[model samples]
Target: MKKLLISLTAAGILAGCSASDSGNGQEGPPETEVKTEEDPVTTDYLQERFYEGMDYDAYAVEIQTWVDKGQASISDTVKIEGQEDVSADIIQVADGFLAVANDSKEITFIKPFASPEDAKEYLKKNL
Candidate 1:
């Protein structure tokens, strides 16, 4: 009985010493935390690439505003190059006009317009 008690005591001591020694009296490597920023939802995301010397950021802001205020709704149909009439809403942004479908599924950029009027005329003829 005494030997068994001593063996248990030694086992307990060894276990406690090993656990304490594993700490090494020092801190571990600092934990790494990752953070991420979500991109704003807007039709401007469809812009493939920015044209040189174009103020695309301002244009993106305008597009975002139009979307937020529900100003992007237009009841008109525009003819696709070869497909049937597609009902699309139009918005004029810097350097061009964007035709966004009712479902917000498609966006077409018509460029070379000095103003919204010019884009309207182009739409009239094209559709």
Candidate 2:
């Protein structure tokens, strides 16, 4: 504000002394044009088009099946909580019937399989 007042004061003083072209004096620098901001357009797009999907289920099932085969080398040590470690024995049982541990008692039938939908269906049919 002080600089502006000094500039206007200098402009006023300079205007009185500057040489006149046709006895009508015009002095000081030309007026600068004030700039205004434009209404900006949004540039983001909803979707990108440069990607592809690959099936992982085939690989997963193949690996699981390979591991399930009896030809796979068996490991020596199997860990269990509060019990002696025993070699993992893949015992076959009826569908939707799984054997899970219950403390030191013999492995008993754990009601409700891993899949709730399958368990519900089994219960509907059997129970």
Q: Give the top-scoring candidate (TM-score).
A: 1
- Please tell me which predicted candidate would have the highest lDDT against the true structure: 1
Candidate 2 lands at a TM-score of 0.16
lDDT of 2 by residue, 1-120 (tens): 999999999998777666454356533322222222232111110001000121223322332442354222212112343345221112122222221222222222234244434444
For model 1, how does the per-residue alpha-carbon lDDT over 10-125 read when each residue is reduced to its tens digit? 99999999888785785432222221224332235324332223243333454455446544433234545544544344554333455543222333343333445665567656
Error of 1 at 43 (Å): 11
Write down the TM-score for model 1: 0.29
lDDT of each: 0.46, 0.30
Per model, state how many residue pairs clash: 0, 0
* Ten-residue stretch with the least lDDT total in model 2: 42-51
lDDT score of residue 78 within candidate 2: 24
> Clash number for model 1?
0
Per-model TM against the reference: 0.29, 0.16
True-structure lDDT of candidate 1: 0.46
